[model samples]
Target: MSFTLAIVGRPNVGKSTLFNRLVGKRLALVDDQPGVTRDLREGEARLGDLRFTVIDTAGLEEATDESLQGRMRRLTERAVDMADVCLFLIDARAGVTPSDEVFADILRRRADHVILACNKAEGSAADAGVYESYGLGLGEPVRLSAEHGEGLNELYTLLAPVAETFEARAAADAPEVEVDVNEDGEVDADAPRKPTVDKPLQVAVVGRPNAGKSTLINKILGEDRLLTGPEAGITRDSISLTLDWDGMPTRIFDTAGMRKRAKVQDKVEKLSVADGLRAVKFAEVVVVLLDAAIPFEQQDLRIADLAEREGRAVVLAVNKWDVETEKQQKLRDLREAFERLLPQLRGAPLVTVSAKTGRGLDRLRAAVEKAHDVWNTRISTAQLNRWLTGMVEAHPPPAPGGRRIKLRYMTQAKTRPPGFVVMCSHPDKLPESYSRYLVNGLREDFDMPGTPIRLHMRSQSSKNPYKNKKKSTPSRLRKHIHGRGGAQG
Candidate 1:
């Protein structure tokens, strides 16, 4: 079902609270403060068995000017236009204010389907407000407490028909397959694990505050889907959106700016940083965005390092490249800095692009795909053994305490950040630098660049055959020697 449900209302109406309840996660950053959400965040939401894409949008504001609130309001309105249904939420405790009524009228005109909902209606204190919601002319409101998880069944009941339509469409759109029936009425077996077309490639853009992450995303999306402004730390939620990028179905994440850990003071900012880290974990490819003027700050390095440590494929993007005067010199300097600062992410793609001007986006896209391919690269056992043999022969493992560490065999243990298991003698004694040599060889020889490689050195756990042998006492040794060799000399 591609249908989308957007939650919209004035600030602090529990719209985000309800969004979290539906998505079954704290994907949206919820706070007591108003206007926390400034962008449209989409998640796979399940209300009972009815599955749909749910959007957590910025609060609908009274302002129509180009202020921050105004931009936020515009973003929410865009969500209304894009969604199949809009869940118009209102604060039951506060009653239906003028702002809520104004948004109600806007939804009436824009949204094809609008579902009126009064949130925080858990007790009798909200009854008056719940009753007052009927005056907005959007029909009887669904009273529920988003935080307490009440009235979802009623909400599911309303959305069931829409879900049914989704199922019907899905069935209708399913591609026809040629069935091969045998004499026993058995069908031919397909591939054990076929790729799911509906599953989009997950990519995340992460960086420091005001690094143009949202702007870069908007450029890729070819629309101002996210709220972008000059203010630092404007994005509080790790918002996700799905789009078709150059013939590839991709789900992109716009994460909050991650500043230095000690500098993150506000509770909401901390939550936002946590949310971005979650997004990094969930993503297959992470684009570490950098401002062209200040390419590799400490925070930027930390974010990139975090992605690398997470075993995610990384693509380095220098945003606002169009504004850089010394393009060649800056590119060379950026590469050197990247190598020095993040040796772990060595050989990763570092493309320059201007998010504001949409320049070099094609190259950025190519780099991302290339990095993903490298991340998922797998080598055959025979090939890996050959490569390992060559690597060991070229520069053998070091000898410590007169015992040389021997690498006996090598095989790929897994892919998607390719991991290898090396069967060797005295694995514990093998130096880390030798492991780096093997990993670097694997990268260069197998053409797996910029992907995090996990090298596991394993030694057999078998015990020595004479481990339980009894030691000879002094008397026993003397008796044996005397009995065997008293007259032999």
Candidate 2:
């Protein structure tokens, strides 16, 4: 394992900003608000040639049991315990407070190694607060500014020796391997492993508030990794977790509940919704979770349609299956409502599950895996052309202005929400209904249900072979005229 560093400090001390700087990406949500980060987020951090695992933790609060802030404190304390070294930050601009002193004492007693950092130390005005940080008795504080990328070299110098020790330990602990020959006469140890080109499938779970989106993820992970309670919008950030599901590596993003835009008046909630939309765009498959008791609400339909419009593979998950009575009637009603309300996701997988009871989770996983595969489905050129030919023969193109529009060729231009391009005559004349028919045919013929299919029609340009030839009088007409003149003479 690489060396681990945890950034811990009181609220609003710029721990997250520094974490984002080190990770070289905006993985953690940053704002002026305190307690924006309520969970421990881990990222691989780099400082020049030094690389290590860095964790951005929730601000250390004095609370220690049961309340929300208490839970957050416990989580941060866990990070402190797991880390090889803790970078305890103090806001130089605001100076040290009682909470910072409390945390400093805790780290001094608990952490194996501690590095004091005074953030917002770029300006001369911060000199007094920088001096005040020395009273924490940790060490000479490393004056730094995380936002402006200042003082990283000093941070690197402190971490270099730690990284070297980690590397040395890893090299020493590596086990020796014995080579063996296989039945095919090849050395088993020398045989190269195939490089994996496909990344972990990205899935985003989204729905209205209190739709059990987080519950479903917790059920799948078989743990309470996400904080859940009898409250709406408990989750504020789009948190991504990696797991092994059914022998497949999957990265699942549990986003904040998305309510209708008109009802969302708060700035933080709006940011949460925007973050959820971003997750949908990044995902290969999106599971639109719905409360089974109140399935297909207007907001739910809107969410599903949004996923479809984003060209993402969609799977409808009706959560709270255990609470619903009259299972047969409920299923029938759900199917009808789904078909009538969201035809854009026609033939998509509609799975019913109880996140509370862990029922139907297997089916949900199966549906997600299947949807991901279909999203990446690619049709061969020959197969696509043949299917196009059959579709055209079954339902010929519209003949506008008494001219038959010819569709000459067709091919798939791309996959991952498969897209096709067709060369035809008068592509503009083709009706939207015809395009829908062709897309439906492609879906049905290729057995690609629930996957988006894109089709493009291009009018083939007509060529004239004799356009370069000068338009001289016909030879026959010239001969007839000459002959007539001779006769008249």
Clashing residue pair totals per candidate (backbone < 3 A): 0, 0
lDDT of candidate model 2 versus the reference: 0.87
Q: What is the C-alpha lDDT of each candidate?
A: 0.87, 0.87
Instruction: List candidate 1 stretches off by more than 4 Å.
Output: 164-196, 461-489
Give the Cα-based TM-score of candidate 1 against the true structure.
0.88
- For model 1, how does the per-residue alpha-carbon lDDT over 169-191 read when each residue is reduced to its tens digit? 98999998996777898543421
TM-score of each: 0.88, 0.88
The alpha-carbon lDDT assigned to residue 419 of candidate 1 equals 88
* Residue pairs in clash, model 2: none
Alpha-carbon RMSD, each predicted model: 6.9, 6.9
Tens digit of lDDT per residue, candidate 2, span 148-180?
A: 999999998888888889999999998998978
